[model samples]
Every structure is written in structure tokens, then in C-alpha cells.
Target: MNRKVIVTCALTGAGDTTGKSGHVPVTPDQIAADAIAAARAGASVVHIHVRDVETGQGSRDTALYREVVRQVAASDVDPVINLTAGMGGDLVIDPANPTVALEGTDLVSGLERLVHIEELRPEICTIDCGSLNFGEGSSLYVSTPDMLREGAARIRELGVKPEMEIFDTGNLWFANEMVAEGLIAAPPLYQLCMGIPYGAPVDAGLLQAMVNMLPEGAQWTSFAIGRNQMPWVAQSILLGGHVRVGLEDNLYLSKGVLATNAQLTERAITIVESMGASVATPDEAREILKLDKVA
Candidate 1:
């Protein structure tokens, strides 16, 4: 078993999860608080997504992002910040008129999506490597090759690491191509995203195939949504990659148990230690991922 696994807590996501669980943090203060608590609970990093405080809907407001980053920066616990630059690519098309943009449509220039990342300059940010049919709805999350190039190049210029979010083998293929093309910087980080409908399914064999497709010397993490979240943690660690967990992915600590970010992180640490491995501290994680530690 690999010792020194890095645990990343995804504080909140751009999902309609807030109404389902009271434990999901909404306001910036709550998000930051939960992030700090996760770090204290043994997470080496925290992935972040801002939501409209009043409506509890995922948002792209840079002010909200600024505040969340600011609070996390000021906290005594210094988990590496990883902001979601994968917003604004959402497109909810209108059935009435296929030509018309729907109410939930959020397509924008890739640079627009990075406005917050450009300002915050977090140690790491995400770029969804490919587009996919989001779900049952007519919605699609768009990340074409041209957009990927722009996002990857911009992230390179900003001196921030891009978490290549691989939703499928094709996404992985293009991500590898980006690496080969020198669009993305060296020591690339890939996140094997699974269990999302219309994306890669959560199967051991499929996950293994995706893992096998990773580039040489690439730092990677993996997670599955819902009940599979915790199980996938062990799968990822055993496969020689880091793990992610939090309210963003799974809501239950157990049957009828709602989970907070800290609890999820604590559980992941327990799993790691139980396997005769240890959880990596932020500094160790930084070294492992080849990140430049912030002072």
C-alpha cells in the first residue's frame, strides 16, 4: 500500500445539493469555515465552488470567490486552494426554440470563466477537459479543443496549476494531447472524475483503464459521486493516486447521516491509515504534486 496519500476536500460543487442537505455550506463564510475545518481534519487541499448565498445556486460571481479565497488564506489552517474554473461552460438549451439560450445557460468565453482565477491566483484551478451531455436535461457542459487550448495556455501564463478534469477516455486523450503540445505546463495534474451520468461510469475496470491512460510523471486524484464516493477513495489510493471527498460529492456519512466536509475528510484519513498508509500534510502534498508552496 502507498503511504502518504493526499486527501482533497471538495467543499461545495455546482450542483443542486444544498436543498438536499443542510450540511452543505452556502455563504462564503460557511464555505471557508468548512474548508479550514477539512484542512484541520487532515485534508491536504480543498476544492472550492461558489454558490449564490440567497438562492443556493452555483454562481460565477468573482466577488464571492474573492471572499472565499481571502478567508481561506487568512485561516490558520493552510490547505492548498483549488478553485473551480469549470463554471460558465454550462449550456441549458431551450426546447421551445433550439436556437434560443435557456434560462440556465451559462456559456462564455474561456477567459471569462477564468476571471476569478486570474484575480485570486490560487495554487490550483480546474479545466474540464471535455464537453459532455450533463444529464437527463438538454443541458451540455462545453469544453471544446479550442477552449481547452485557451484555458490551458492562460492557466500556464498565470503560473497556476490546471487540474485537468478527465470525465472520459476521450477527455484524457485530449488532455494528454495538450500536454504533448506543450499547451499545459509540466508535471500536469489529472483528476479522474467518475460516476456522473453521461460521463465515465464508476466501475473498477473502467477506472483502471483511465488510470492506465495517465501520462508519465503526472500527479492525479480521483472521486466518484453519491454512495460510491468513499469506496472510490480506497480504489484510488490502492491504484496509486490521491483521493477527494466532501459534501460536494457524497451527502451521507452513513445511512440517514448527513456529512460535513470535515467529517468526510476525517473518514478518508481513517480509511488511509487503516490501509497501513498515512495521510500527507499540506507541505508533503505540495512536494508530491510539485507545487510551489505559498509563504
Candidate 2:
């Protein structure tokens, strides 16, 4: 067993899950508090996504992101901050016309999407590798190749580490292409997002296939949503990778049991420890991720 494992807590995602679980943080203050709690519970890194306080809907407002980042940085529990650059890519196309976009569509330029990351300059920011059918129906999470390259360039210019988010085999291949194109720096960081609808399935074979395609000396982590969340924590560690967990991906410790972000993180820690692996602290994660030293 690998002696050291890093646990990352995705504090809040952009999904429409606020009403489904009381643990999902909707406001800036709640998001900051939840992140701190997860850090205290054993998470080395915290993935963040802010929301509209008034409607509890996912938002791409820089002000909300600023507040969340400020609060998390000021808190006693200091975990490496990894902000999502995956917003503003939702494209709801009209099924009938196929040429027109639906009312709820929110598409923005690649530069516009990275505005928050450029302003805040977090330790790490996610760069979604490729486009995919988000789920059943007319929606698509659009991340084109040109957009990915632009995002990666901007993140590199800002000295922010880009955490390449791979949702399928094609996405993983494109990520390696980015590495080949010199868009990503050395020792690239990757996050394999599994079991998210039309993407990859949450099975050992699929996970191994994704891992096998990683470039030599790449630093990577893996996670699955819903019921596969906890299981993937152990699977990741056993496969010589890091793990991610939180209310963002799942809201229950078990069936009929709601869980707080801290609870989810603690559970992941327990699983890692049970496998004879010690959790990596935030400072250690910073070193491992090669983050720019906070001044």
C-alpha cells in the first residue's frame, strides 16, 4: 500500500443539488465554513464552486468567488484552494431545431470563463478537457479544444496549476495532447471524474484504463459521484492515486443518512487510513502539487 494519500473535498458543485441536501452550501459564508470544516476533518485540498445567494442556483459571479476565497484563506483551517474553471460552459441546445440554443443556456468565451481564476490566482484551478453530453436530454457541457488550450495558457500565465479534469477516454487523450502541445507544464495534474452520466463508468476496468493512459510522472486523482463516491476513495488509493469526496459529489453517508462535508471527508480519511495510508496535510499537498508559494 502507498503510505501517503491526499484527500480532496469538492465543497460545492455547480449541480442543481441545493434542495436535495441540507449539507450543500449555497452562500459564500456557508461555502467557506464548509471548506474549513472539511479541511479540519482531513482534506488536504478543497475544490470550490460558488452559488447565487438569492436563488441558491449555481453562479459565475466573481464577487461570490472572491468572498468564498477570502473567507477560506482567512480561516484557521488552511487547505489548498482549487477553484472550478468549469462554469459558463453549459449549452442547452434546442432538440427540435438543433441550431438554436434553449433558454437556460449559459455559454461564455474561454477568457471570460477564466476571469475569476486570473483575478484570484488560486493554488490550482480545474481545466475541463473536452465536451460531453452532460446527461440525458438536450444539455451539453461544451469544452472545445481551442477553449481548453486558451484556458490552459491563461492559467499558466497566472502561475496557477491547472488540474486537468477528464470525464472520458477521449477527454483523457485530449489532456495528453495538451501536454504534448506544451499547454500544460511539467508533472501535469489530472482529476478523473467518473460516473457522471454520459462520461466514464465507475468501474475498476474503466478507471485502470484511464490511469494507464496518464503521461509518465503525472500527478493524478480520481473520484465518482453518488454511491460510487466512497468506494472510489479506496479504489483510488489502491491504484496509487489520490481521492476526492464531499457533499458536492454525494450527500449521504449511507442510504437515508445525510452527511455534512466534514463527515464525508472524515469517512474518506478512515478508508485511506484503513489501507495503511496516511493522509497528506495541506502543506504537503501544496508541495506535491507544486503550487506557487502564497505570499
Models 1 onward score TM values of 0.98, 0.98
**Backbone Cα, N, C clashes tallied per candidate:** 0, 0
**Candidate 1: deviation at residue 290, Å?**
1.3
After superposing candidate 2, which stretches have Cα over 4 Å from the reference?
none
lDDT of model 1, residue 99: 86
RMSD of every prediction: 1.1, 0.9
How accurate locally is residue 193 in candidate 2, as Cα lDDT from 0 to 100? 94
**Model 1 poorest 10 in a row by lDDT:** 286-295
Clashing pairs in 1: none
Write candidate 2's Cα lDDT for 52-151 as tens digits. Answer: 9998888899999999989988888889999999999999998899889997798998889998987898989998999999999999999999998888
1-295: candidate 1 lDDT, tens digit per residue: 4677989999989899988999899999999999999999989999999999889999999999999988988889888889999999988887787788788889998889999988888888999999999989789999999999998999889888899999999999999999999987778999999989899999989988988988898888999999999998899998988999999889999989898899999999999999888999988888887786544
Q: Model 1 lDDT vs. the true structure?
A: 0.91
